[model samples]
Target: MSATPSSKLPPFDPRDPLGLDDLLTDEDRAVRDTVRQWTADRVLPHIAQWYEDGELPGIRELARELGALGALGMSLTGYGCAGASAVQYGLACLELEAADSGIRSLVSVQGSLAMYAIRRFGSEEQKQQWLPRMAAGEVIGCFGLTEPDHGSDPAGMRTYAKRDGGGDWVLNGRKMWITNGSVAGVAVVWAQTDDGIRGFVVPTDTPGFTAPEITHKWSLRASVTSELVLDDVRLPAAAVLPEAKGLGGPLGCLSHARYGIVWGSMGAARTCFETALDYARTREQFGRPIGGFQLTQAKLADMAVELHKGILLAHHLGLRMDAGRLRPEQVSFGKLNNVREAIEICRTARTILGANGISLEYPVMRHATNLESVLTYEGTVEMHQLVLGKALTGGLDAFR
Candidate 1:
């Protein structure tokens, strides 16, 4: 006998028109909702003022709250981490970036960059020293890989670490545009060594180590950007991340961070899209709501398609990451497409909201501005394109 068709299906949601919710497990929804509510309660009301003031006041307290929620290092195992799946972490990132890219930058730098570096490459002693505190957000951490003159080309970094007569590592160089740099208790700094590139787990308070906060940023103004100066910073022999040798260590951490951006950028886009949708439905033009116009509908339709498509792409990458089968090239694909698309979505959203879009009263302009920085960081669009090009072309060298 033929089976009868199911009589019920979930009602359509305009916001999530593609019915993407069905793909998430109950646990996923819980994680997403928890983060969403946290951001709604904690970030939404204050973000405008914070963005305007160009500061993230009470950031340490925010970190502690994030830690209490098991979000600081949500995906890593042990050492006080929540050990949730990568997808859960991605969902949390989306929610965080939905509120503000700066907030997500803070978490991404902490968990994906700093903590992951130590967890994946540091010795047991190093892990025992830092991970638990970092995971608990009792100690904030920063990753130092980008230098003033060397961003895409980390191999040419000017930061150098040398062994002194006492066999201690002496670090001297600067890392620029570092997130959480000024507030970080510890910095996982990468520098050139005799052996090759090495990562040092330097305590921020160590003598000769200083992170001076960078001011006057138009993009991601709410985030702390700093220049980490290592003026003959001395460290014990054990300070080096034992397993992290050469460029691969930092690059690996970057891949992980970029994966989060793949999801996080979409979060920013989602917020902008929702804000525009709300405005279009309510704002009247020529005695009719703007939503009634075909032009407005087309804009909304295009935004929805790209937004959901980007979300779907992010989810697919998250699953790949969880399965341990994700490739660097695949990550490049996601970062390249998602960040670019996310920026476009934000821009389109601004157009929908018209003059009000530029106001900090709405999130569209803020997200758009924040995404400009996102577009340049964690491997620029050009770098990702080259990466994908090499992969697709079977190892053709594009960069000379």
Candidate 2:
């Protein structure tokens, strides 16, 4: 059967070649646009300066603003959280990272790691006392799982929490590469105990708790990275998260954070891709726009394909998450693939922009450097590969 062509179909938009926007509902589009506007108004204009200064000045003020926007814990229910769907949270991550990966890291560490730990494992009193303030950004929180000596193998962590004669829990150890550490009012410190591994909700002002800022970092300079030192920090029995036990507790929180990275990395790629595409169209060589050349066109075409494909993959994961069917191995798959591809896109974009790409005046170099950190944090490439490998090989453990 032959069908007549309809003129009602909309013309293809270069920005959305695959018409992926059609997949979003009106509410979803509204959420995405709102975050996009917020980033344009607040983040994009000042990010270069922030990156150059290696400081996120007025970070407390920004936290309050983000809290007002319900971006602190957008997917968590109650406790003043937005209670949004996982897809919406993923969209917010995308928009935030489009401005800077540091910004997205702040949100991920806050909502996915710290808040999720308390919400999922803490006692009711703990949740009631902390979640509201954390969600409102009145108090910022940091997750302490990764140690100076341990990155992938967290079971070897030297940090220990022990019960004293008075039933007080005493902690001692150091955590490295902790985001939101110095500024966080609270720290969720995971430590080895007599029973096993347990999590402690320690106030930053505790007598022996100090978060010293890590300095002179070339990557993620606009973000707060610190080392948490807990020397005999004492807490009441109520401070321990009762529900979580063993290494699974912290690993669960990490899986949630990695899910956000799956989307956030693509956002960085999108910005770089757009920068390259626009530059290719306007920059001229041999008495014509460079985009007129076959080589430039090929780069743009390939970048576009990968960039959108990553977004599609993130969306698929977001859906699975919302449906409560997402597995840790699957999350590892998304994180491994999207972050690797996103970095490649950024490097390719740098080539398209020539020397201008290296300048802070352009975002390409900053994003590229930032993605370098993103590639290793959460879970390194090797870690995720082992995860997928074990899954495929029917539980063949390779980390020995």
Candidate 3:
């Protein structure tokens, strides 16, 4: 049976289906609106070009602009941060990522991983020294946990830090696939120690610290990805983050960033869906708009269902986070479901766009490719599945 196209299509609202917009408080709506407009004005126009060029020029200027908008470290309290609620932070992430995942990646690495580490585990002096500047975007930050040999199994990481005769810490390791690494002023690097895994705040300018840009990437080309090499890098005893011990510290930070991915992935899917919808409404095939075809309509319907549901899940998780009731396993659930579904949505949208979908002019392909990176980062899909499996099995350890 052929589906009949309605004579008049409803106004497109990819991010807000099921009247979810009505549920947002005024502040939440305001936060979403602000980021939406900023992306429309500043990002959407140039993001494709930036992605194609494989670099975002004037990156520092863009960082400052994000700071001025109070986007950097927006959810964290004090230290020149915005102290916005988790929902607002998630909304901002959605808007930014709707423009491009690269943009969202910048904010996530800076705020969720680096800044949050300091705020959650750093001493007052460490926080005072870095958080303010990082929140203001005067100094960019990166988190170093994933290494060349150890990604899924960080416990087996070879990167290690040792105490010198003078009581200073000497770090020796390499971190790979680090976002914002090349541009970072400071790196929150985690390394194995005799006392178990520990995190250290190393200035980029410190002796023996080098961040070499990783090029030729197919995904996240607009973002700065790099390899962090610490060849006997020396840091003061104060540089060690006093509170973060063992794998829990870096895993905690990954949870924070993964939460943002829950929302950001939906944003990317939304862009692809909207773009595909607009194209289907106009492009003709067999003397009718392609959207009039039953097949295309089915694709659109499925994409819409997943996109909206992902947003709803993100909102629920955000509320939990704001209330301090969120759990790591819950975050894992959201990340696994949302990101997996989002990539599916993007791929479906790309099919709806047909051959044009593969082109950067349409944004469908770009978003789809970016989601490839999104799916793997923070926590891989398989890893999250194990987490949920453990949760269901009464804390049974499955990943032996």
Taken over the whole model, the C-alpha lDDT of each candidate is 0.94, 0.94, 0.93
lDDT of 1 by residue, 324-355 (tens): 99999999999999999999989999998998
Q: After aligning candidate 3 to the native by TM-score, how far in Å is the CA of 275 from where it should be? A: 0.6
Report the backbone clash tally of model 2: 0
Model 2, TM vs. native: 0.98
lDDT of 2 at 235: 98
Model 2, 1-400: lDDT tens digits are 8664667667877677889898888878888999999899999999999999999998888888889889998899988899999999999999999999999999999999999999999998989999999888899999999998999899999999999999999999999999999999999999999999999999999999999999899999999999999999999999999999999999999999999999999999999999998999899989999999999899988888988999999999999999999999999999999999999999999999999999998899999999999999999999999999999999999989
The sequence of per-residue lDDT tens digits that candidate 3 reaches over residues 335-356 is 9999899899889988888888
Ranking by TM-score: 2, 1, 3
Model 3 alpha-carbon drift over 4 Å, by segment: 1-15
Off by over 4 Å in 2: 1-8
